[model samples]
Target: MDSFVNFFKKIPNKFASSAKELGKVQGIAIIAMLLALRVVLGMFANIGLAFNPYVKIGFTFLPMALVAYYFGPVCSMITACLGDVLSYVFAPAGASFTPGITAGYIIEACLLGIILYKEKISLPRTIICEVLVTLIGSLAINTYFIYMFYGLTYLQLLGLRAATLIPWAIIEGILVAVVVKALNRVPAISKNLPTT
Candidate 1:
């Protein structure tokens, strides 16, 4: 209803504010560094779980979440897209580049920004955000892409992806909360973060 409509209305303003971050040299440097980290982590550090090539556990989410926290949704979305594309370019995986998978990561970044930007980082909030991202971005969106590419039944794909996604989300949520809290203790880093 009205609240829902108002939420949509605010999105543009949020994006606008996020876009302004690009005007700052520090912002550009931070986002570029983080995006590079995301690409590297995605390419090399990912662990294939359950012997399923489709399912992976990676720390790429950390940089994306950090981007969301620092720069907001637009920057996070850009970072997500670039990270995926760059990873593919540097280390080609699968038969082809899948736009749907990139879309899933974009959704993940946006969700992270919406939940974490300018908000106090807490265990509950981080857990909820990660869970939602897992459900929507990984289980739903990425699964669809994987199904399309691999010709696997949707149910089978969902089951395989979910086997690790749930635990990974919870673990990642805890990690994000802890890392952000620890980072905030550093005056240099905290000074750069957006105030709630």
Candidate 2:
């Protein structure tokens, strides 16, 4: 614990200052690839879904958070919004733009990146963070949109969606932790660690 604390204290002086910062180049590249991957994933995810459009795999946020974690919360937020813009620009007709979805993605990705930017990257902590962000950040924002426009109180919508999303959320949470942790382990990515 003492060593850990000392290491953290040294971060700002050691890496944060001179550790060759990860600029917009990395951030933009990662986000662009992430957005493209999302489109491909979305295309595949649409198949076999008979009921809800929103219930498919939610892995898109993971990479944004990864970007944020490696870059910063502000970058994550910007990337998420940019992704929404790209998604809108590229999406075919009938797939209109949605500010609500963009807001939710930005919120979730920013929170995840901001929350774990300094904390030790344990799997448990990562999973908990993923769940917290998805539930409080993404779900809350989207549910409010549903409540305001679609006809449902926030709490009622929360209850309904929470219950419905429990399984999907759990699975995605695990997936996020696994995928991010694995990515973190990669030397190329880990070398570009967050600003302590």
TM-score to native of every candidate shown? 0.91, 0.70
Query: What digit string (tens of lDDT, one per residue) describes model 1 on residues 1-45?
Result: 996686667777777888888888988998999999999998999
Tell me the deviation in Å of residue 163 in model 1.
2.2
> 100, model 2: CA deviation in Å?
3.2
Whole-model lDDT values for every prediction: 0.89, 0.62
Residue 196 in model 1: lDDT: 49
- For all candidates, the clash counts are 0, 0
Question: Best-fitting candidate, measured by TM-score?
Answer: 1
* TM-score of decoy 1: 0.91
